[model samples]
Target chain A: MGRLKSRQAGKKFLAVTGLFAMGVMLLLPIFVALPALAGGAPAAGGPPPDVVAAQEAEGVEGEEVKVEIGRDVYYKTEGPAVGAPAPKTADTEEFYPRYNFESRVLLWVANQQHLYYGSFVLAVPIFCMCIEFAGLVSKDKAMAKKYDQLAYDFVKISLTAYSLTAILGGILIFTFLTLYPAFFGYLSSIFRPVMHIYALMFVAESGTLYIYYYGWDKMKDGLLKWLHCSMSVVLNVIGTVLMFLANSWIGFMMSPAGVDEQGRYLGNIWHVIHTALWNPLNVHRILGNMAFGGGVVAAYAAYRFLSAKNDEERAHFDWMGYIAMSLGVAFLIPLPFAGYWLMREVYAYRQQMGITLMGGLLAWLFIIQATMIGILFLTTNYYLWQALGRMTGGERFQRYIKYFVFILVVGLLVFITPHTIVMTPAELKAMGGQQHPVLGNYGVMSAKNGGINAIIMTTIASFIWYQRGNRVPAVKWAKFGNIFLITFFVVAHLNNIWVACYGYFIPANVRIGLSVPQVAGTLSCLFFGSALNLAMLSKSRELGPIRWGQIAPRSQYALIMLATAFTWMMGLMGYIRSSVRLFWHVNEIMRDNSPWAYTHTIGFGANVISFNVLFFWITILFVFWLGALGAKKAPVPATQPVPGAAPQPATGH
Target chain B: MQTALYLIISIVISVAYFQFIDWALMDMQGLDYFYILR
Candidate 1:
């Protein structure tokens, strides 16, 4: 039909636009960087060569003259001052305006809220891209349609949050300008060049996201859907670029570069943007966002499941929750490694900062974070086990659940154990040391690493069992495959524990290296164990139908618990990272002379984090309500029972 | 015998893979993985 041809041409047009947009987003950074590179920033503590030549010629032709130059604090490069040093602010109304309330606390609330919404919006688009791609590649038409609907539902939830993110961003900027004008002004001046680029990228992201969402129905088939899917890739690239640009500002504040000791610019913007902690931060945030985003989506699915009017709705929501949680756990597994890298970079940049975060004042927050991490994994494993109840042959693995719990509980106890406790002089004398003798041994990083890795390995094994719950591998090599998996996991756990035990006997410097191997052991199980399990299940026999909507309500609550833990941990970590800066606005480069520069008590910090978590949840619940308001029927029909594909509504076994 | 052989071979392969990961990752960070031996 002519309509079909027109649709085909429209698909080509959208595809070209998507590719063109991606090219621009990719090239924008290169174009921005090349000019600055070509500008030829000076050597350390000296003027540029051209400037030196000009000055010499002038002196030879006339009277002697001197050209002033500044050395970069981080890069050690030097150039004539391109901008003024950071302003010396007094506690006057001009520098720090206020209305009988604490400015820092207000800004803290604003920034945390903005970051929460921003992370959610950015993470959802990437999820959409993944789900949409999966749908496009799916050979089964019905499965493909369901995937498309799931992706659509995800983007719809984010669309409302996206608008709120922008509004919060504006509010944050206003808060900065009003509360701490001097500090904001100085940062703005330093990051002036890239600020507009960041703004443009935001606008581009908004346009792409809108088109990708609104064009879904029109481009439901063939090449048009591919174009729509590829547009999401462009959208995510822009979103990530925006996040990096924003991270650069924070990176500059933490470990300043391209500026002198006096905080004067030395003409190289790249050094300022790409500070020592930048890449580590970028990696950490990306993984954190993905995990956090998955948690939120899973929670939404759980909410829908609880209130579902019928079995079909319950089944669809249950499957949705599972997929979201799996995606979350996948990212959550690698998150600790990213955190370690960030911590390592912090140590590399400034040892005092690292000490303050882990061993000094903010150390208690880390204890809290470790507790949350334990809770998250425990809840994830519990949910997976409960998920097995929906299958007929699931009872075979049910007896092993207690052992997984035992291992997990042991790991959790070791992980949450503290190295030392605050004690009065008399109490310290009575105890003879800050550390409790036997318990303290378990509190060290070595034991903690072993504990967490064991927990992660156990979670992975649980997932593999869940995946193969009702199916028996029919391949000739199935027996060997099963043995290999079992051996691999058992040995991996032993290796991890051995490494942890070894760390206690080794030098601290060398002991630090042990974590790398321990992490590898855990990751090896995740990749190899899971891959081989999938291979074994490729031509498996089904034992029975996997009853989809038959799961207990408690499993949905577990998803909610996982999401809440993720949100709380995010707030806690953000507080720790920001507070570690101590009294400085930009580390040592700029001082924060405000009355509230001192760190709050741990109790107060916890209260503030709790408040942020509560506020975020209350608002997000509203967003979910709004999403539910427009709902009519379930997105996917009740899946018919099909053998070998438990993922469909009906059958796994 | 085949089952035991399968387990042993898997254990060997897993151990070798882990050892390489440990050495390479630590070496990348400029740390010696066999610091105790050295």
Candidate 2:
């Protein structure tokens, strides 16, 4: 009994010691990291006993940069006389950074560039599908041949863009190494293996891309076509892998797992990469990129249309815009869900950060995001309405547009209001609170749920409008489809509104979960309505001839503007999501520079991002116009997919 | 239908597994990149 007791006591003691050691490792960093990240100095009267001892033993550089009583050390930097920042010495209020802003921003920009470059390269192959479809459907030999050439152009453009992307990647790497040698050292050490994998993936991607683009002609036939399509899939796969690898780094940065709390290097890199938030961020980012890419491509199409000299160009541009819009909106429908999932994970990782994102620091950005989403929906509706005039049965659908306009606009305004204003004490006394009374509810999940669903519902309304005017259905179940369309949306709306209402009263977690069902309902209607409409139109005919080049070109530019808006909004939303950890570099553990970390006003953020979008659009438009300028117009075949003459009216099936 | 259901279940499980592994790898290396020392 005595021996047994001793053995058990020894085991208990070992377990207790292990727990204490682990606790120390975790808790010590929580105390150490905060002041370091905040750039806060030791108290002014005298250095802490510990700090004094450390200062006494300081290295030569440390001794030279002794802390003054009041002023920040960062104020004495040895940079340019005109452009220099304060010195980053012991006296500075600024934290001893692992890195500087330029280095930080470069890495940030590099990561973004990397994601987008891969996205564009991957998207090129996906766009190839339309060309393949055109090749299959075009009855006239001449038309089929034009489509083949178009496919050739698509691949050609991707090849050039791919090269630019590579150059950008190289530039990013060099910038990282040159700007923050110290920070780069710390980063490169941890991510050495990931960087190796990324390098290999890029090489593989380059080779595959070249082969895919060059081999198009060689593999033009049935088996070759299959091969070509397969190559596109491979390209996307590799691109996705690259994105995932990169996401691991970003995700880990936000929620570094597998390490003891002091930010020490852990043995298993995989543990770091697959931090809890990694998967959701990957999902959200990938979807956002696809939607953004679609918008960009669509805008390009619109730009082409606005510049076209004749009807054929207009017709082509119109079709391209419609398809691009469709693709963009299609990906966009599920985007909010992914975003929601990301936010959910953020809350799960740390609730304080999530609260700051929604209720405190970054809430204004969310309001702006709400406004952008509203614009996206509104523009989408207007474009669809314009496109409807070209279709056979399109006129009847025009009447319903007014109702949708009202619902979407009302929902949008309510969605974008700031929940909490920066009120003076006097203002607070008048208002009776920090949070606004009636307006505060609009910033809640209930209002956003309603707003997004309303937006979605409106987009579907536009799609239905467009579908109605474009073609007359030939399906045996045409009557059933009409009924289905009506019922599906009606039921979907009822369900969504029900949840939105109930969400207001429920506990927060339950209210949040309710959104899943609501979103799923909208998706059901969106897909069901779309598929039903497509099936109905497959064998249908045009009620009227499409007079493409007749419309004002400025109207078409609106599509490009919408696309640009989409990109900027996505970037903004991404930043907001990232900045949720209000003052933390990493949530809770690493405090950020609190003053700069607060969100700038919505107006300012929007103007700057719009500038980014505008800059890109102008440059890309120039590229697009340049590409089109060299084009020689080939004669279009008389018959499109339809059986009859110019208008292809095959109405009475 | 049963086979399809089983296959879907298996696929979901596998995907979750892979996603977890991939995410964890990213976390360790990525945190440093973001300057999250703690």
lDDT of each: 0.86, 0.62
Estimate, for each residue in A1-653, the C-alpha lDDT of model 1 and write its tens digit.
Answer: 99999977977887678667767867876886575567664322334469778889999999868546899888787776766899987788998999899898899889999999999998999888988998899888777777788899999999999998999999999999999999999998888877878998888888988888898888787666777787888889889989999999999988988888989877767778899899999999998998899999999999999999988788888888887887777888888999999999999999999989998888888999999999999999999899999987899998889999999999999999888666689988887787767766758999999999999999989888888888889988998888888888888988888888888988899889888888878878887787888888889899987787789999999999999999999999999989999999998899998888999998998898889999999999998887887665444345642222555211110
Using Cα atoms, each model's DockQ against the true complex is: 0.65, 0.02
lDDT of 2 by residue, A1-653 (tens): 99999976775665466445545644664687577457584311222368556666775446664332221111221211111121122312233333444334445456445445556666665666556555646787655665566566666656656776777678877775665444355456556678888989888788877887777776665544655655666666777878889888767657756444444443445555678788998888777776777787778777777767766666766656665667667677778888888888888877776777777777777777778888888887887777666555667786777888888887787667667776789999988788667656656777678778877877876776565565678777666566555655655666567557766765664555566556656666566667767778777766776554444565576687688788678667756766555545544334444235455566765665565555555545655655565464645464453212222211110
Please tell me which predicted candidate would have the highest DockQ against the true structure: 1
On a 0 to 1 DockQ scale, where is model 1? 0.65
What is the iRMSD in Å for candidate 1? Answer: 1.4
Runs in model 1 with CA error above 4 Å?
A1-67, A429-440, A633-653, B16-32
Q: Model 1 clash pairs?
A: A544-A653, A646-A651, A646-A652
Output the lDDT of residue A121, model 2.
61
TM-scores of chain A across the candidates, in order, are 0.92, 0.76
| lDDT minimum window of 10 residues, candidate 1 chain A | A644-653
